[model samples]
Target chain A: MDSTPEFVRLWTSHQAEIRRYLFLVVPRARDAEEVLQDVSVRLWEKWDQYDPNRPFVPWAIRFAYLEALKWRQRQAREKLVFSDALLVQLDASYEEEVPFLEARRRALQGCLRKLGDNERRWLWLRYGGHGAVKAEAVESGKKLRKVYYALEKIRVLLLDCVAGTLKQEGWSDA
Target chain B: MLKKTSRLDVLLGRAAEEMLSPEEATELEEILTRDPEARKRYLQYLDLHAELEESFQLHAVAGGLGSVFFPGVSGWRLWTGAAACAACGMLFASVAWAYATPVIQKAQRRTIFTENFEDRLAHQPTGLPRAPGAWSGDDASVVGAENGVLPKTGNSMLRFLRSTHAEENTPKSAWCDIYRLVELSTPPALGSRLSLSASFAVAPASDGEQFDIYVGLNALDTYPVQAPDLDTARNLSNTTLGRRLPATRNGKWHELSVDTQVSPQTRYVLVHLAMLRRVPGPSPSHVQFAGHYVDDIKLDLLPSNALPVKTP
Candidate 1:
């Protein structure tokens, strides 16, 4: 049986987990995403060996961590943001923590909906707005610090809401 | 609220932006290495950071006018006009990042433009067939965010006030639409394709004629504004790709997206988002609009060989 369809189905469901796993090990967005691409190719080449009974992410994430370390090695002249010991330590335990991460991600949607006009505008300015936004902010007579502080406040609100929402939804361990 | 921000949280925030100093990075690793609780907080914050970025990615070019998000169509044009005096083409960096990727490397996907109806300052449609080409709609079309009307995403959304829009000085009630003018002087990639996606929300359900929503991506030889007057309906008819949204009575947002290959000779692309009243005969009601809403308009340019991302 050609597992192409099955591989595509399982890969679609678990790719985000792998992206998140790589994010923890590789701090740079472009580099982390690069490692993700490499890991994706590696996974597809090896999908014939994947066992349905075994958890997909935990099995797949090992490849992401390995490629991430290779990226780290290429930049070894500089001090590493995340040490190898930490990445290895994380690989062993990340599978247990994914549920809470996913729960938080779900809770964020509801929290975003709860934002007021000003709160939403601040998030849009800091995150969704374009690259020259800092200079634009200054030129428009709005303080960059004001936007940063406002963003920090909003993130706290979102994180708190996530925790509360999960608890209310009976995710006690979250 | 959490009492005082932790040292770990401060460090992680900087880390998300890739701004952490070498010393700060080492310290961050030490804390995560020693404390189990700290490690948990690190993962949660990093997860939050990534999720927030991804959500914004869906809304990357909300209110963007080929460059940055403009509060209103005119205000942004004025601001960019004045800003461009200092640095020409600096503002038009909407087409930034054109890295060469072979057809097979799909991970390098990037959003080229978006128009989430976040602009509240416009009373009439903003981009009405200009020499450069921009957004165009009816005098009745406006950004709505009042009377308990909620957008699918962002603070505001495009609301059709009436069932008719003026084209060539004649009011046409066949469909009410908002047009996004995409003028790409050069093809993004030789084999790349363009993806247009949008969300439409339902108003009151009707019995007489079913109202359908569609998003149109049409590649044109000349820019929309450069086209002679009486532009819209003529260009829309030459659509290269049209995607009809799924019919739903649930009163929720319906997402529709389409991908089309842009010919190398293509120069300008007109994106049409409309609510159509396809009844055999005209009725008294403004059925073309039928009170539906549009939001979260996004356009992405993907390499020709781009495919769904493979993962572990």
Candidate 2:
């Protein structure tokens, strides 16, 4: 197994895309993360099989897809999830949207800066920390229902702000 | 005025948090099937959710998250910062390799001289000078006949033709020598290695004709005044580097290369492209034609690093 610097760099650049691809197919985030870890070890073990002339993401994704199928088979008795056909369609859709997602992510920085202090604090509380909603509700002295509602409101505002910014930059749904 | 939260918004929010009940999941799926706008909004929200998760991990470690409500940001900042730095370093290293690798390869081995014969014609009109760099013997001619064997690269090449008498059972030989002299700005130091190579093709009209290559090097003063025979060629110059004899006479181009060390007294490099034949007794009942074609000659002075170190 070659763990050369070039191979490692190729793996690092595509790690996030591999994770998202696995997550889209797997039923649960925990299972997706486990598949991601397995895929990483398997890629390193089979690194010799990789052809450097080809693009790395599609090659790595082929391995990730196989690993995800294995994980799905192991969890077959669990709740129903996306079928293989649907997963393929979703994967294609996600790849098509990658450029748009990148633009959205960049626009997010400016939108984030425009958020009110209270809104930023809410985001940091819900996503910036590893705490349950109940814990967050208790800490903020708000009802659990109100905390969920506030978090939802914050997401809506950020989504609208991002859409507005994208439109200004010539982004269109079409 | 605050906008009322729609059912699609509630469903998407629960889906992002992975807390959607089975009934809500069914409802959301139905809505996505019925409405393209709902599906687009769902994808948008999901991407934003994932992006926020990534950003939190990135900024939380830098202490760039300016919120006190999120505890443990400092610890996350420390570990995340180190990982980001390592990743960036690897990325830069890969970029450096992508840009600098070709330059290094080109520098390590340079081309000292080359000839593709583009300037020469296989059959020139009378009174024109021969190709500037090439010198051919009296028996040799440039064969640019349209029906003859084609050159390996350009339109022309040096050619040598030999025909045999039908009844001369004794072994007979015929050959032609073509050479070019390459001048270097500085004489190579003793023991420096140089490579000489060329491409050749042969079409033997009969079974007895064969083609061969003989390479030679000499000082400028004693360079051959005329084409030398095989025996005289071996003894003529500062060095008779080597020879390559092909096994087959099928009109296909073959490359031959020889590596030799530079002598301290060497001033001129002469590359000889020779075609030789041996016809056995009782040759054909009719005259047979055998021709040789040559092109793309090169002599490279290999870098010192590429050469094997000489024993002291």
> Which portions of model 1 show Cα errors greater than 4 Å?
A1-14, A53-55, A142-146, B1-4, B59-312
The value of fnat for model 1 is 0.27
Stretches > 4 Å off in candidate 2? A1-4, B33-37, B67-312
Candidate 2 C-alpha lDDT tens digits along A60-147: 8888888877776776565445445445555556544544665577778888888776777667656655553466578668897777
DockQ scores of the candidates: 0.14, 0.09
**For candidate 1, what's the TM-score of chain A, rounded to 2 decimals?**
0.81
What are the lDDT scores of the predictions, listed in order? 0.62, 0.58
Span of 10 residues, lowest total lDDT, candidate 2 chain A: A78-87
Pairs that clash in candidate 2? B61-B77, B169-B281, B169-B282
